[model samples]
Target: MDRRGHGVARHRDLSRTHYRNGVALSHETGSHETGSHETGSHDTSPQALTSVLAASAAGARAFARTTSEERSGMLHAIAAALDAHAEELVPLARAETHLPEPRLQGELKRTSFQARLIGDRLRQGLLADVRIDHADPGWPMGPRPDIRRTAVPLGPVLVFAAGNFPFAFSVAGGDSVSALAAGCPVVVKAHPGHPRLSRRTAEVVAAALREAGAPEGVFALIEGVASGVAAVQDPRVRAVAFTGSLRGGRHLFDLACARDEPIPFYGELGSTNPVVITPSAWRSRAEEVARGLAASFTLGSGQFCTKPGIVLVPDASALIAALPPVHSGPMLTPGLTDGFRKSLDELSGTPGVEVALVGEPLEEGVPAPVVLRTTAATVLAAPRVLELECFGPSTLLVEYAREDEVYEVVGALRGQLTATVQAGPDDDELALALVPLLAEHAGRVLWNDWPTGVTVSDAQQHGGPYPASTAPATTSVGTAAVARFLRPVAFQNLPDAALPAELRDGASGPRLVDGHLKTPS
Candidate 1:
């Protein structure tokens, strides 16, 4: 099949190349190959690993010292490279993920566009929030020192790739881009489900770096769960970016926190992104609410972290009547499909819940979308029902009878990435009351919009408290994502020549010096 004049091809198996350790790995672009295990551990030669790490570190330091213009140029190069390699990557991603071609293609574009957007932001010096504070007469003592704030590299970063959006979240995706732009070297722990695709993307990025004259150690790609653990624990690694299950993200978070010199771990863990529909809103636009919820729940087969897992509505019948028919679709992978089936069976057998929509099971690798329904009182009483993130095309509707109960249930929600409210024009009171409450419960709150589509813009917030993310104030999908890898240092008094180039004043422009903003001659 051809998509937009680009020939869509299936993934072709490359010959396996064995390493000295007897572990076998495949090369996506050339005959040269390396070995790494899927379980995050490997017995590979230390020389190969060292070389990769050194190159990545060099790239990182070079990026750190680079002018905003240089960094922006490198990002543009990355975008062009990704566009050039889309054909090969999309097909490999599809074969590895079992996702449709169109979805993969869309993701490819999103990923490339995100890189370009970051480049644009870099050129604008978004991270360099240069502020000048002058002496004020209102000061109690002497003149106040000028204070300015700008982001700096957090050093080497370790990115744990997510399984669902391999291209967008993998080796050269948002996490890596943000970190690189912030002057941090990146070491990516490739997702096991799409290691080959990750390797290919990594190569593309490496080529871009070489062509752009990026320093070594700017980027490295490693596979295996053990290697991931080691990378996070490595003292050289200063920060972490991860998107995955709560269990996995928390483990890395704990590991980072327990380090001798602890570092920040910004993880976008799983979320049961909830949507609350007030009684009045439901009465006014029950059908509209239902259709919107249906689309949000099933998009990407409910694989998105922002997928609405639970709907709080007053009328169960209205929600049921509005839902679309359940249909089976290929999940991201066979293992995920099986896992969803087991979860569905377990939830169906629960005492208070009833299956609202169910379809016949498909072959072992296919997942059928399902919708389960239960009363608000029952769900509130048994909060465990709301805790589970059914990571497939499934949603549970919890019917509440009163506004107070809806508020009570929402208040009890664990930290969430996003909480959405669907209210009509007439439901002003409910909407007003719910906004602050939802904001407190999640990192981002939405009004009359689904949370599944995350924009890579400055205003976008992609992290939440606790379960939604380990760090609520940090985001994984916007310009702010770079902050996860940066730390600020204050400079009391230092000579202008001693200051870093970014802090120094020159005809070139204003620079940061000894942690303060200054212009050097």
Candidate 2:
């Protein structure tokens, strides 16, 4: 099979063989179901997957019973373990991903930091949205009975590790961190692009959770696309999370919905991340905007989900001329490079599209940066043909003559992860008019800034409507991410003894009591 664990079935039965040289490893029969089967012919059989999912189902209950303090310790332990093994893990990651050592190191550090940050936020009572109402006969609505509500963990979550970000978006990344913080068990499906790193990373995480006294099945890792598809359909898998191309995400999402008991599928699919440059802003700092646009779109060889695929400007010629040149760069995987090439070809071949600049030629397998320019009328005329995403070190510049065309173009856009506005002081009215319109189509709107770097914070919103994400009302980053794996349960007239600690009278943390906000004393 190819490194990405796809289109190859020869290794499926080697459930017990020791892996070497970072090759593909199947879900096996040993501890965590990671051992090879005795017959040596077992692929990720339905029976093996059932055992893994069954264990996770049991772990979900045990993890849910853990105190916030205990869960916090578990997350911290995971962070420490990742940091401690950075030396060993980074090299393996580099070998599998072809990413630089420094970039991998930083991404590993960020992954560990995200774990601890989620732990800190969990202890702060951010995951639990608690509300209580005492009996009030004179209530405006009606006679209100005693009621309490708080979020509860769903169950076992299946996380599909991302290929591009092997460290930050892989095994122990935000999706797993947030779900575990919310008291759910996690089973990560390894990405084929970096299977060796995925295996080692899972070993580290599993050991950390064990040492921290977490449930045995609190975390596990499996391989292969068939395994992932089966896991999504498994009843024991409560929810699913993913980060990848729209085609893959949509396929898995459809499977999740088609299950007997349909569950929530949180998929952060790629976005075009449109950017607009007002006439005044372009006139004032045309060079600056040009440089920033080039850098943002080409960052990480333009694999980022938030890469600015389309930029709207009044005149494309000046921005195109002022933009700095970029060199050819390596993409994460061969599949990705192929997709990038095909997308670029389709976009460049469009009838009205014009090539603005092409970067230095590089040998095969390495892609050069490209910039394409076309008119707003052309884009409006052929929205389906022109507005498609080209997922490499490339971008499209669409020139508009009137402000109304800006609105029309923005309206033509589907949901986006982010949309940016570069407006000068002289364009205050235009920026003001554009903010709400952009907000309607995007999850986050930026002013005079780029959208490539996503901040991990309480206010961070990393998801958008439709193709930007499977669940637009939720985020796959920040503290609020934990909320996705939790569902609210309200108890009406239940005895205090039957209530969760957070819902009891005189309980601690921030909560709403009789419609008034109260902090723990």
Candidate 2 lDDT over 345-459, as tens digits, reads 8888999998888885345658889989998899899886434778778899999999999988999998899999999785478877999999998899999999999878889
* Prediction 1 TM-score vs. true: 0.86
After superposing candidate 1, which stretches have Cα over 4 Å from the reference?
Answer: 1-51, 58-60, 134-139, 143-149, 360-365, 501-521
lDDT leader? 2
lDDT of 1 by residue, 129-179 (tens): 554343355566875664434456888888888777878888788999998
TM-score of each: 0.86, 0.92
| Clashing residue pairs, backbone N/CA/C < 3 A, model 2 | 4-192, 15-36, 16-36, 29-35, 30-35
Model 2, TM vs. native: 0.92
